[model samples]
Target: MKDVLPYFLFFIFVENVLDLFFEEDLSWNDSFTSVATGIVSKTWDLLLAGSFIAAFEYAGTCYMWNNYRLLDYATDNKLASFLCFLMVDIAFYIDHRLTHEVSILWLGHVQHHSAEKFNLIGNLRLSFLKIYRTWTYLIPMGLVFPPQMLFFHLQANNIYQFFLHCKYVPKLGPIEWIFNTPSHHRVHHARNPKYIDMNYGGVLIIWDRILGTFVEEDEECFYGLVHPVNSNDPTWIQLHYIYDMYLKWKQQTTWSHKFQSLLKGPGWRPGSPRLGFIAEIPEPVKGDSKTRIDPPVASSLNLYVVVHCVMVIGSVFVFMTKYEKDNTNKVLALYLLLCYLSITILGRIYDRKKYAYGVELFRLLFLVAFTWTNEGSMVQFLRSICVASSGFMITKIMEPPESILVRA
Candidate 1:
């Protein structure tokens, strides 16, 4: 995890560009309030789906952990289980493909791809527009692999992909083949004609090759969905596509046009001005400039998350020393005692250009062993991450309320 710290910094840098463009002081308190506003403003989807997914992921994690030993053994020798993982990942790839092709599945996936920018937050983005969307692959995985192996495989795949989101590295020559590379993912995000709807593989690029949907990254890759829309506000991101479709319908001269517009495929171009097209392919200009989103986090938040995690590292140690004891110290270290207070407080405060250097006085004690790193103090480190994660959840909860966000 420490090795992947640079990628987090890279994410911040990208986000900073957007923060400045929008002149987003985007305070923590405002974010929290905005999230609440979004939740209250939601339409078209109830909280039930979100509730179910939350419970599903939590329950799945618990069940998987109980069988960790077998899972670990399978992973201990990569070559031994490579064939097995490949078979299972095939199911994973198929599941991912369906998310784009199926209308109902796209509803859930739209919440994730809805983000305008490509950054660290984008990597973690998932939605509960419908229950089971987040863990949809588990159903496919269950058909073959045990629950424990499925969980570990899923975790490993995500951990690797998190690093792949970085803009820092250009390409890793040989490694690019066996595993999904930045180049491959760049193609995945492309909105161009030949590039669109291609490269759906996660761990292996061969899946795309085998499926005949593979498109190599040759021209410069432009990352984002078609019909340029920009906003770091998670609420806006969630509702953007859905609301855009409604606006497209409202703009249409006839109900037939409106009905056809919504029913069209991913790359469809509509007659309405609001959403000229639900999707598009690049026509190719003589010279179309590329766009970059944010500046590298003048400070990286990765170290901040790591420090917060370390606080809880000694939890087992403390537990053994004081069995059946309630200790605030370890709780302070993990920083997860009260999930609501921790999340809410962080949501209410934020500084876009923040590096968190002076936040932790306690870190000074271990200057020789630990640098101040990215965050201010240890406590501030926890605050920063909690703010980000909670802020996003709040935004998601607020967007597309159960009633209706916008009319079709």
Candidate 2:
């Protein structure tokens, strides 16, 4: 699986390129943000994979029922694989549904749905905190299956889910009834009243059908949260909902009400104008008004940002592949810093913030200083040159018109 990581990345990149360039189904900023978030999520996954595996091993060894331990039985029996897969699918369905229904859980799950555009890149917009809670859901399965089997099946489920984020695939005639396809999963991502909280299955759709949580694709799906995130900042995308819940908790007059605000469904609030379950549908906002800032930027600047983002992403891949256990802390810190600076600078650029160029300059200077202290590789020098030149171009292009500047 480690060896095949590049292939997986390539497949996702190709799909995104086809969708953005050929299909024209996504916006440049939306796609860029989604891809950036996905890259950040993958970076965290690489940094934390060892810790999660250790935790899983410990839990499975200590927590399983003695007589019910199915490791030997499952290993010897070919049928056990299918049974274990079924168990994981069911576990994911329940966990995914609960995340939507419980406000606290929603805090960790909301980032995955914050994107207004549905594309393969959106699949990468996962929450970092999700690693902590998602393992808990698999603990029950640990009671039966071994930790190894549980981990394998969990990855299988997720890999199947990756391809489900696209809009290119239409409803498969018979397969749609059994497996969770692109069409069915689209309903899960939508905020439409008819589609909200439906189709929670990871690999199988039968759980949703049997449980009466399934809704067939009908009306055009509007992708995103009830209230659009409207910003491309990855930090804000992950934390805004948690902050909103905290604020809501603060507004409560009593402790119990405060707990309710934190634990209740997203629609729940205190007092009059309380919304019923079905009536909690979000009022539609005009699409044009969804974006808060849209300053005109040169096409060359936009292309530069995209190219620089790709370079950062490739650098991350190289770092992860060559990362060593001995220097794990140093490598992880530098990698995360690079990714953070890249995304933050790109987000500021997309919003046309006047300070974007300044931040980009600072980031380039930091990179140069860091390189100078090390080997001062030619690759680093060339990258710094490209980034600085692009930043200068963007700064000049985004300058206000002379008349507006004079009035100010």
Q: In TM-score terms, which candidate is top?
A: 2
Backbone clashes, candidate 1: 27
Runs of candidate 2 with Cα error greater than 4 angstroms are: 1-4, 20-25, 43-76, 271-276, 283-296, 373-381, 384-387, 390-398, 401-408
Off by over 4 Å in 1: 1-51, 57-84, 114-117, 134-137, 247-264, 269-280, 284-408
The lowest-lDDT stretch of 10 consecutive residues in candidate 2 is 399-408
Candidate 1, after superposition: displacement of residue 264 in Å?
5.5
Per-model TM-score, in order, reads 0.52, 0.86
Could you give candidate 2's per-residue lDDT for residues 112-156 as a string of tens digits? 998887777787688876777776666656667776776788888
Native-referenced Cα lDDT, model 2: 0.73
lDDT of model 2, residue 70: 54
Candidate 1 lDDT by residue in tens digits, 1-408: 335545654765565465567633322222232332232222112222443464676566555545442433443455635655786567667867766664335555665454334444455345436345655555434433555555567666767676565544577888777678877877776666667667888888888887887877788665556654434334444556677766656777877766766665444345434323423445544223123222212122333333333343333234324532343345432322222222222222222212222222223233212333545585466455445544443443344432111123
Top lDDT hit: 2
